[model samples]
Target chain A: MPTSFPPPTGDAEAEDTLSTLGEFGLIARLNAGRAQPAGTLLGPGDDAAVVAAPDERVVACTDVLVEGVHFRLDWSAPDQVGRKAAAANLADIAAMGAVPTALLVGLACSRDTPVETLTALVDGLWAEAGVVGVGVVGGDVAASPTLVLSVTALGTLEGRAPVTRAGARPGDVLAICGRVGWSAAGLAVLARGFRSPVAVVGAHRVPDPPYAAGPQAAKAGATSMIDISDGLIADLGHVARASGVLLDVRSRAFDVPARLVDVGAALGVDPLQWVLTGGEDHALAATFSGPLPEGWTEIGTVRAGDPAVLVDGRPYEGPPAGWDHFTR
Target chain B: MPTSFPPPTGDAEAEDTLSTLGEFGLIARLNAGRAQPAGTLLGPGDDAAVVAAPDERVVACTDVLVEGVHFRLDWSAPDQVGRKAAAANLADIAAMGAVPTALLVGLACSRDTPVETLTALVDGLWAEAGVVGVGVVGGDVAASPTLVLSVTALGTLEGRAPVTRAGARPGDVLAICGRVGWSAAGLAVLARGFRSPVAVVGAHRVPDPPYAAGPQAAKAGATSMIDISDGLIADLGHVARASGVLLDVRSRAFDVPARLVDVGAALGVDPLQWVLTGGEDHALAATFSGPLPEGWTEIGTVRAGDPAVLVDGRPYEGPPAGWDHFTR
Candidate 1:
């Protein structure tokens, strides 16, 4: 039924922590009283799960979130971490112009973590995948020194050719279909200790990716597509290098939402830096040789030059770098 | 070509370590000179990988290995750990009577890990998956306080219904195909510091699951099957409980390979205990209404009784207990 679980139920928290529940016990609890979608031919508790594939081909991707690096428990709830993990992986499937069908999640955490916290995280995982009409078919739980959430998303292209990053060419127009700096603005509000304007703060914890825009752009003949995960300019740099062409984008063309502007004023920071240099919103950024897709804002044009991302006739040097797991 | 990689080639280990290469640089090294199989519609270096789902349905499973809990880096090399990780996942697919196709790996390690060690792990991952004629389509790497490897395996049923644990009937016969206590014996030798016989130690480091036997059992009309991961008795108890019947077996029926018996004698450990209580050998145990499949050794009989596992008509108790990740 795609139900959601908040913080932790009193009954759940009253139970012994994960160590007392045991691995198998916790897994059984996860499947208890839950119904899977029809696409899940086989659910958890088996050696492997069988998920129906609507196409002869499946798109697969994996992402990992590490404790202290990706999220801090004080900054976000367990559910928010679970949601962001699922959202990031699902966005990759969407970036490939496919609909996500199922997710296989693996979690490793300290034995002291409460069972209620784990259940809340799992609830968040299902709730996020449910938003895209997919299911969590299988997963593994293990003991670790820190909490780690790893997600693998499987999707189908529905007979459409996969839109690769190399398909963009000169004269194609670059467009975006979702917000630019919401999560970054949200992060700033959280990092700078601002309590008001809960929207950005909440978004920093769980990103609302444009799930439908991926397939919609694919249907409308997107030459190349990518999710703005590592900032707009930084992610566009990947397409530019892969397509072997320069991408010239207008700074003003990016829709800087009012929330971001308001947050910037509160923190005395430049909102444009968040718009151009921030990431993790999972917005759809694609290049099209024809008319822009519905609801997409034309942001730039592909040019016949060196492989790079240029903003307003020059290379962007706002943040000095985008997010890198190791470097960060 | 499914070729094996020899330990750290000069070209691979000569590159800068992960600290200097960064995350993207490390990924670029992983994809530097590797060519994917034909079934991989699109390989790594993109948002997600596209794999051929020939049956229009995919069987998925996941397993996680945490250092200090699953393996000790001091006892097992990085390559062995990687091979064991891949082999265990591949075994789950085989247990479902399916052919594994693609694997997505997610790794989290401390920042100080050497690039050479990481590449060796990856090489071993490919070498093991290559044994089953599949490729690693995608993976994620992150900095973690402790090393954790999580693998998700995708397989195809090939028009056969999955051989689940619930299909065992009262009149069915039970059989096993592969070594039963090799890994447990290997662990004993390693813990006791035995040096002469290296076979058990090697087995402990990297399991050799009989991948072909699973499909063969399914083809020969075997009723059900499961991989011997959580000890023979513990795993059989699951099948017995699930099928609502008793599984009675003769202790002598189990083939205690000579190496295990010899190792037990030297350590004063009961060899039968290892055979009945050991796990992680990745051997296949199945039930059949007809004659046993080729190469299968008849070991037990399915009976109409309370759900339990009995050895020689009595309840069997051996090792202190099977592995419980949380408890451990």
Candidate 2:
């Protein structure tokens, strides 16, 4: 339905480029006929938007995605890029044990960018927000040499306390819900100029974050929670340091997906390495002292020791491991 | 005091670049020793930040600034750019009759960028947010070819209704608070490579938006409100269209400051034109049916007619007006 929307400004031929549609016209086109959730007090087209925060607090986070650095037009469609950008921030809010209320985006692109591309990107943003019953409440667009998207997600805790990284206690079980290594395998396939494995490639393009499992984990007595933006080992390193406990992941605990195993064999790399170190899956990773949530799988335990992450009781020994934006 | 903060890493010489400091290290440097406000329930280093929303609703907005598009490093210091970016979004919140509570920033830049530059920019963001007693709650950094800043501001309405741009009615008086055209004049001087006349040039670097006046105007029964980011006429055009009313500005209403007058005379242009059409001063424009609030100057009136902005009851005749990121 979004794709069927009319061209910006009604003059189909003249609305080819952003410059031709103009900034305000483009905004109107993007905002036209979108339905906001009940939490949206005021939607786009104003200086700011108002969203309900019934719990007396709002959870917020921001994530930046750059063209070529985060995604390439040749590898993923603009809509896919938009979905990935929104998911990155939305997952952060969910990791805080909150239900997303709204999203705000800031986009920078060249003047010559096609109007269709921009509209499709916004369509993706809307589609993702719709999945969680939220809306793209506000945003701004500007001209820049490289395309960049910065998204901020707001959510409500619904009266529960936030599950921070510092709360994990020794003896808590570490668990994860959602796909992990699929994105890394997808990235590998893309880099090698092969795209037949649509599952991995699609995983790389748009993550399927478990939106409800975050609050479900919190309600299930999660001591600490985090979203896997970096690889499992590296991100758990943060939890270990913050909670002042040792986190040990048992490699045998994982039941590797058959597709990833096949891809790994074809590429001559251990699939477990990708499972341990792959990032950007936006998977929900948390520690629980009580029973694991319905969708969660226990893979490790927290122990008393100096802060550090271990695989099978020792330092991980495969792949480059973890992502560092600047250094990488 | 912020300037006195030490280098990104303990080793001053080796930690000069972002690549050397690394993403986590750079984040640590930017967040080190900064005191978060009381409303910040959870600050940075978490998956998401939780901020107090006592009013049961949050007002939010986002704005983007690109390296060569919004500000130039050669023309403005990194700190100034940060302040400008923060101010741009903060003003939007204020225009909604809300008090800013927190800011979330997303930054993208080259790996070779100096750590000092990035930290200084964060200092400016802190400095600006500090003015309204808020904190930089959460953000992300990524690698890109050019520096791009995306700021999302959240605010509370304190149980008051948002004074949107659609409520203006016939016979309402239009008023303005804070400086206008000063930044435009400063831009003119900067374009000519004359950085002197510190007053105007400084205005270009950092806007002094009337933060308090927004709520004040609302309390005084403002019917409609907006902030002047684009030139007055251009921004008012939005209010006019949204409110479905004619807005007429009186030429003699403004008492142009002597500084701006002198600058205009020197540059061989009309200072009044700058006051009418210049932008980025972050001045508040509101319509009221009652008495004007403190610091507010009556400038025009709303009339019954089709949506349009008129200067002296006619179309504006002056230099190219307003800003469009792509077209201009």
DockQ of each: 0.75, 0.85
User: If you superpose only chain B onto the true chain B, what TM-score does each candidate give?
Assistant: 0.93, 0.96
Error of 1 at B110 (Å): 1.2
Best by lDDT: 2
The runs of at least 3 residues in candidate 2 whose Cα sits more than 4 Å from the true structure, single-residue gaps closed, are A1-15, B1-15
> Quick one: best TM-score, which candidate?
2
Off by over 4 Å in 1: A1-15, B1-15
lDDT of 1 by residue, B1-328 (tens): 1122333345545545555567878888766776678888899978999988788988899999999988988788999898988988999999989999898899898776888788878887888899898988998998899899999988888888988888899999999998888888888888887644789888889899999998999988888788888788888887888788899988889767788888889989988888887888899989999988789999999999999999999887665545678865
For candidate 2, write residues A5-37 as lDDT tens digits: 353456564456667666787788778889998
Chain B alone, model 2: TM-score?
A: 0.96
Model 2, DockQ value? 0.85
Against the true structure, what is each candidate's TM-score?
0.95, 0.96
Retained native contacts per candidate, as fractions? 0.86, 0.91
Clashes of each: 0, 0
